[model samples]
Target: MSPAELAARLTDPALRVVDCRASLQSVSAGREAYATGHVPRASFADLLEDLSGPVVPGKTGRHPLPEVDSFVGKLRRWGISRTHQVVVYDDAGGAFASRLWWMLRWLGHDAVAVLDGGFAAWVAEGWPVTDETVSEPAGDFAATPRGELLIEGRELAELAPTARKVLDARAPERFRGEVEPIDPVAGHIPGAVNLPFAGNLRDGRFLPPPELRARLVAALGGTPPEQAVVYCGSGVTACHDVLAFARAGLPLPRLYAGSWSEWITDPARPTERGDAP
Candidate 1:
């Protein structure tokens, strides 16, 4: 469904609408924004808190996947049931919402979707806003993880060659190892092609399907969706790429959340310099 359609679902009590607006650096702003005003019946979910878990050493990927049981517990605590329709939104279109969308889909829930235009569009549309601080009544929602949706460092490393096409969603400079800000080391995983997440948007909103398809086709060359994986600094922005691909009717790529941040932290994980691929 479109972003506006998702917004229309806001008034539905059965739907769980979450506001995922928060910068990667500052999470407190999300709560404050929610406290001030948010879509009616919408609750605030901190990306790092509600969407991700503590970073594990060595074994898991950079933004290692959250414990399935813990995630299901969080869903239950949020009053989301298996049948509940979930719509996630953020200021940057589906940049953040796409993370929640991917997580839900990975758990085998198909009813979930990212709000197309995000909160900014909602406000622009003159939709109702509330600061009521919604607290969902607890419900039972069990989560079953789908292993195929995840790709560990080793898996990505092995697949980076002939198995799959690695797509880096960071800026060209960052991907090229020219400037490092958040990660200890810049550059990207060897063999990963650069496709900045911003490329998915045109003036803050996502590009139309045809445009997205054309851009992604150009990026992918001939590689099919199953033969591709998308990553970003901490796995947050890469979801934008995944959302774009989905919008373009392409297969969704596996996400590497621990992305560059987690990758550089481990010296054993190989690194590359300059833009070769």
Candidate 2:
């Protein structure tokens, strides 16, 4: 939903707002920002504690998807009922918030939406903000994982000769192994093509449906949307592309939760550099 649309429905009884601000460099920064000020009636959701599970050495990536039961408990804690119209936002465009949005959809909840342009867009409009934190009574949200919406690194590594399109959501430099600010070795999965998450947005908001569809369709080449998969550094920002797919009215692609970080943990995994096939 657009910031303007969200602001207009702030007082609607079924509307729920979540502040998902986070910094890739520092985990505590998002909560600190929320304490300073946020959309009125918004409750903060920490990317580390609330959204991700504990990292498991070389197995789980930096932001492993939380255990379903634990995430369900969080949903209840946040008062996310099955019927609530949930809107999630973050300061870093929709990078972090899209994770929550995708997770909710993966759990079979269809009423969730990422606030286009995120918290920055809200503030830009001079909408009312408050430092006061709010919490609602526990809700009865349940978990029903949709495995089809996800793709694993192992399966992706073997996708050759098949008509699948593996899209990497990292920056071009990272995709080309030119520079990697995070993660061990640079470069992308052997056959994956680059499609930085930023391509889905313009001036902080997502591009219109037709434009997004054209870009994504062109990226997919001859592969169908169902045969497409997306991933990023630690499986976080890739959701931005998934959200864009939905906005484009295209079939949503699968997410590689472990992503590049976990894929590179095993030295035996193949890595390509310089865009050479």
Candidate 3:
């Protein structure tokens, strides 16, 4: 949703705004940003605390998917009901916000949207912001996880390059194994294609649907979205591409939540360097 559209609907009681401004570099960056100032009546969702589950060291990725029941509790505490329209925003494009957007969809809540251009655009447009925090009455949200919306590492390792086309949302350098910043292993899954999430946006806003469809559909390489898989370093930024695909009117693909971090946990899996596929 656009800032103008959100601004117009701020008075609607059923509208919920979430500020998702977490960082990979610093854990407290998102909460610090939220405490500084945010959209009026907007609540904050931290990347580690709210969006991710427990980290199992070598067993899971850096940011594991949060438990469904726990996330449902947070949704209710945020006053999100079955009918609420949710809008999530962040300063770093819509990368972080898309995580919540995808998670809500995974929970079967389809009324959620990422604010186009994110918090930066909201401030750029002279929209109002406040330092005061907001607290709403507890909501009644029931979560229904779509088991089919995910692909395990073992399944991805087996079917990729044959039955499915895997897309990696990490930067070219990381995807190419030229430089490794976060994860111990450098390269991506052997058959995964590079589709950096940043390419989906220009000036912090998503590209037009035609442009996105042109880029994403080509990456699909004749595979249907339902049969495709998307991932990133720890499965956070990949949702940006998923959100972009949705904006382009394509069906949401399965997310490899364990992503490259978990993929490397097993040394038996083949890793390819450079952008060949």
**Candidate whose lDDT is highest:** 3
What TM-score quantifies how close candidate 2 is to the native fold?
0.97
Judged by TM-score relative to the true structure, which candidate is superior, 1 or 2?
2
Instruction: For candidate 2, give the lDDT of residue 14.
Output: 88
- Cα lDDT over the full model 3: 0.92
C-alpha root-mean-square deviation, each candidate: 2.0, 1.1, 0.9
Model 2 Cα RMSD, 1 decimal: 1.1
Residue-by-residue lDDT tens digits, candidate 1, 53-78 = 88776543445557788888878877
Per-residue lDDT of candidate 3, residues 1-277 (tens digit): 9999999999999999999998899999999999999999899999999999999987899999988899999999888998999999999999899999999998899999999998889999999999999987789999888888898998888774677789999989999999999999899888889999999988778999999999999988888998889999998999999998899999999999999999999888899998855
lDDT of 2 by residue, 1-277 (tens): 9889999999887888899999988979999999999999888999999989999988878889989999999898888889899999998779999999999999999899998888888988889999998877778998788999998878877777355788899999999999999887889887788989999989988999999999999888878787789999999999999998999998899999999998998888898887835
Better by lDDT, candidate 3 or 2: 3
Best candidate per TM-score, number? 3
Error of 2 at 98 (Å): 0.4
For model 2, state the Cα shift of residue 47 in Å: 0.9
